[model samples]
Target: MLKDIVDVLADPVDGTPLRCADDLSRLVSESGHSYDVARQGYVTLAGGRGLNHEGDSAEMVTARELFLSQGHFAPFVEAVTERVAEVIDKSHAPEPVVLEVGAGTGYYLSHTLDSIDGSRGVGMDISVPAAKLLAKAHPRVGAVVADAWEGLPLLDASVDALTVIFAPRNPAEFARVLRDDAEAVILLADQGHLDELREPLGILGVKSGKLERMMRQAEGYLELVGDAELLEFPIRLDRASIAAQVGMSPSARHVEAGVLRERLARLPEFMDVTARAQLVRMRKS
Candidate 1:
């Protein structure tokens, strides 16, 4: 899978082109920098200092896989795949490359790749655990452990479409890597998402003005291609699904495990909760 996207990768230190080494187990840069491919099949593309923060832990990644596999976020995944298909159809690139930043477990990336023909993906996340799962999530995807805050380790204008779902975005770097007509499809969680669980679970709520702040940040480098579309749906979740949802989110980090369990025990067997997010399309300015 790494072989599919090897030509698009760049050296994290100096931005030199990269190639597979003699045996193809390592990636070597034009400037002679070497990065070993992990036995699990992913590569870490951080610079000399290495990553500052671990994006997600193995527990979190496992919880995410469990929660998503249940299809609780089917609407979100469908919207992402639909938008990517539209972007690819418009571009008409014979073999389009889709890069997903902060791609947790490669769920969305794999789904999009399945929907489009002749499409490959780069699943970039800072978490090594997440990268390990992403590496094997699909046959057409290449997983890389890299920070979203840092510039993406990709060649200039190399991507036909980029996707960021419930993750960080670097608009300037996205603009540089995306082709002229390519778009960055972002799915941002809005207020009222998980409102039913917030009070009982004692977790944080979505802050107001989050989307507006994101648009302001992307003003110069990326422009909003269209109005943001809100995708809201309700799901009947059991206690286990509720636990997995909380455990995979930032809320998991704030609350103590025992306390969360105690609270979850008091809830009904099934709950009707809203999953809300905004899908926005942006293009290079």
Candidate 2:
């Protein structure tokens, strides 16, 4: 379905419209820039110098797929999907486009699409492994490989609803891509998220004032639309689930594989852990 979002796509190097060419095997831009569509069904739209950082590794992406599939983050996903549905309904834009930044595995994006009728998703991520999963995550999703921190590979004011869950954000780029009436739904881990597993597993803990800092960062580019919503829930996680949670997070990079395995084995057979996060909606200023 790369053709589904062709109109919204712009040349990463020059922000020009792109068209499916060579019988849809390539994307040719008006400025003479061309990008090839991978046989796996995704495309990389980085600029001349390429991406500055790799978003997630194959192992991290795989772990994320496994963890998310178990539905531990169901509340978080539901909140995001409901917010997206509300946005799409209020916009009255018949053919809506939803963009998910750092859309790893496309779990949240695919869910949002299912909730909103006739909506398409742009699953943008920098990792090839993530893109591979994103390509097939849903029938209506168009996966693109690009850095989230840099400028997004999209046309100005082309997106209807944007979602970012524990992902990087570029306020200026977000403002540029979102329409004036469009909204951005953001979910950030709050203080005490996964606190139960931190000490026992020696994993990283959530920092305080994350939402406050994020609002401060979005000063000029975006403004808060409604009151921030807080969601906190407890999940019973087995040892395998615990490992998957840690493996898909920044803590994975901090701990050595063997040492981390040993630490996981020391935990109980099953433990109750809190999954806490805050959801906020913003509009382009």
Candidate 3:
């Protein structure tokens, strides 16, 4: 899998091109930097100082995998995959490179890669646990652990398409890596998302004006390519899925497990919760 997208990877220290070593167990950059491929098949492309922060914990990643595998968010995944297909179809690159920032567990990235013929993916996340899962998520995906805030450790103008779903995004870095025809597809949770679980589970709600703030932030690096699409769907979730949803989110870090369990126990057997998000497609200006 790493071999598939090795051409698009770069050394975090100096941005040199990377290639598989003699034995394929390690990657050596043009600058002579070597990063060992983990037994699970992913590589950590952080700077020499190493990762400053862990994005998601093992429990969180596990929760995410469990929750996502249940297909409650199938519509969201379908929308992302469909858009990625459109982007790839529009691009003339024979073998396009798809990059996903803060790609958790590689769920969406792997799905997109499967839909696009001759397409490879780079799944970038700061969490090692997430990277481990990402490495094996698809046959054509290469997983790397790197901070999205610092900058994407990718070659300039090397990416054909980028996707960000419920994760951190750096527009400047995106602009640097995406080709002229490439677009960055972002999915942001909107206000009233998961409203039914907010009061009952004591979880935080999506903030207002998030999309407007994001557009303002992307002003210099990226411009709107099309009208943002509002994706709304209803998920009938059980208590376990509700727990997994909470466990995989930021609220999981603040709430005590026992308290969260007690709150989830009081909920009904099934809930029709609203999952709402906006898909904004942007391109380098």
lDDT of each: 0.94, 0.93, 0.91
Candidate 1 lDDT, tens digit per residue, 211-238? 8999889989999988999999999899
Tell me the spans in candidate 1 whose CA falls farther than 4 Å from its real position. Answer: none
Give the per-residue Cα lDDT of candidate 1 at 216. Answer: 89
Model 1 residue 213 lDDT?
A: 92
lDDT of 3 by residue, 211-285 (tens): 899988888999998799999989899989999999999988677889988998999999999999999899998
**Positional deviation of residue 178's Cα in model 2 after best superposition, in angstroms:** 0.8
- Return the TM-score for candidate 3, rounded to 2 decimals: 0.98
Candidate 2: residue 35 lDDT (0-100): 98
- Model 2 alpha-carbon miss at residue 166, Å: 0.7
TM per candidate = 0.99, 0.99, 0.98
Instruction: Count the clashes in each prediction.
Output: 0, 0, 0
Pairwise TM-score winner, candidates 2 and 3: 2
Clashing pairs in 3: none
Order by lDDT, highest first: 1, 2, 3
